[model samples]
Target: MQSSVEAIFAPQPAPEGYAEHIGTGLTLRRSASRANAQQVHQLRPHVVEMAAQYDRLTMPVEIIHGDADTIVPMHIHAEELIKDIPNGALTRLPGMGHMPQHTAPQAVVDAIDRAAARAGLR
Candidate 1:
């Protein structure tokens, strides 16, 4: 992550107008908030179909989420992903925000190591 971008999301004292976009040259294009809402709107039937596909594939899976993240709600993504898989687990990190690799590298590495153990990769 860029220093300026990370600095923008850092915890800080409450300030008026502080939440305004902080950078000009940054370019990020993920599915829009509008698209996310649409996807969530279509969740139920989508999940049923997705679960069927997952069951057919029979793939092992794991999900990692930062509990304090606001940008992408962990419960919304990781919880659903875990629910979709037969033998999947979701790990939620306490006190970490948006990106654990940036906010808590050691914890992220530890999670990876544990995942590796689960996959017999270690």
Candidate 2:
């Protein structure tokens, strides 16, 4: 969907499929949704509790992760998640670290856009 709210000044224009969250910080990322750090704070408590539900999700999931992610090992997190999620897929960034969105913004956008299209969002 096109952004109903037009963007003005930003650290950089949020790339396609991404939105800039300028509230707590001018952070930008396309997480398959418009959730920013502030919004995440509210859901933090429930995230761990919801992990078990990933396997039960029927929605298509696209995981764009880094092969070198030490913080959350790709094999452990992304690989395992893709296996669990019924309609899930994964794209790995060869040399990237933990933050694929920051290290490979365009790639992240492309992956998210594909996922959104599959989910009928774009």
Candidate 3:
């Protein structure tokens, strides 16, 4: 858990205009504080348990993930998740990153629409 926290807070070069868009300086201060690690540790078990039950989900599941995401690699996270879910559908956005809603809003909306249609909610 300590290693996980360290990786998350590990310094990386800022992407272009990142600070400008968020209107603040990117700092590793919060990561160094280790407050988030405790919260994650508490929630990790619950998250793992829920993930294990993905095969039992009856509702439509729409998974939209960026193919270019390094933080949560497509194969390791979304791809693996879809394999476990009976009704899971993955929408892989080419050349996109972790934040698909911000990077590919239309694709995200379309995926949501498809999920709703599958669930008869739209």
Candidate 4:
């Protein structure tokens, strides 16, 4: 389990707090009671169909993705999102991994702030 989680961080060392959080989340997702885990994993297949409704999304979206992330495929989530959404902005962090909010909290914050401005919320 540690090795699998380690791969998600890759070249970067996982910060202790974030690592623990991620590990706990992973444990929960894999537990027998987490029935919705499959539903979350299965969402990728519906992105194209769901994206057809992107025009109705009346708010801004900010996708902060790591180029090096191996957990969730970038093509399925971030790339597809930034391409399909009219008001979507992407911050692609090179050499970063899955946990951008931890490794680059400021970048995440900046993205949120940008999204807020775009949505007229800031």
Top candidate on TM-score is 4
* Worst-scoring 10-residue span by lDDT in model 1: 10-19
TM per candidate comes to 0.56, 0.58, 0.73, 0.76
Give one digit per residue, the lDDT tens place, for model 1 in 1-122.
35545544443222343335433333333545567678789888976776678745444465677777677787777877777677676778876667666566787677778767777788
Candidate 1 displacement at residue 103 in angstroms = 0.8
Residue-level lDDT of model 3, residues 48-99, one tens digit each, is: 9998888999999999987777778889989899999999899888877666
lDDT of 4 by residue, 1-122 (tens): 66766777775777777657655555655564366777788887696688789867768888888888888767768997787777777888998888887788999889989988887888
List lDDT for all candidates, in order: 0.63, 0.67, 0.74, 0.78
- Kindly provide the TM-score of model 1 when superposed on the true structure, using C-alpha atoms: 0.56
Q: Model 3 misses residue 68 by how many Å?
A: 0.7
**Any runs in candidate 1 off by more than 4 Å, and if so which?**
1-52, 56-60
Decoy 2 TM-score against native: 0.58
Write down the lDDT that model 2 would get: 0.67
Which ten residues in a row are the worst by lDDT in model 2? 4-13
lDDT of 2 by residue, 37-105 (tens): 558678866876787787889887889877766667788878877887888889988866665665578
Ranking by TM-score: 4, 3, 2, 1
Model 2 clash tally? 0
Error at 66, model 4, angstroms: 0.8
What is the RMSD of candidate 2? 10.1
Error of 1 at 65 (Å): 1.2
What value of lDDT does candidate 4 attain over all alpha carbons? 0.78
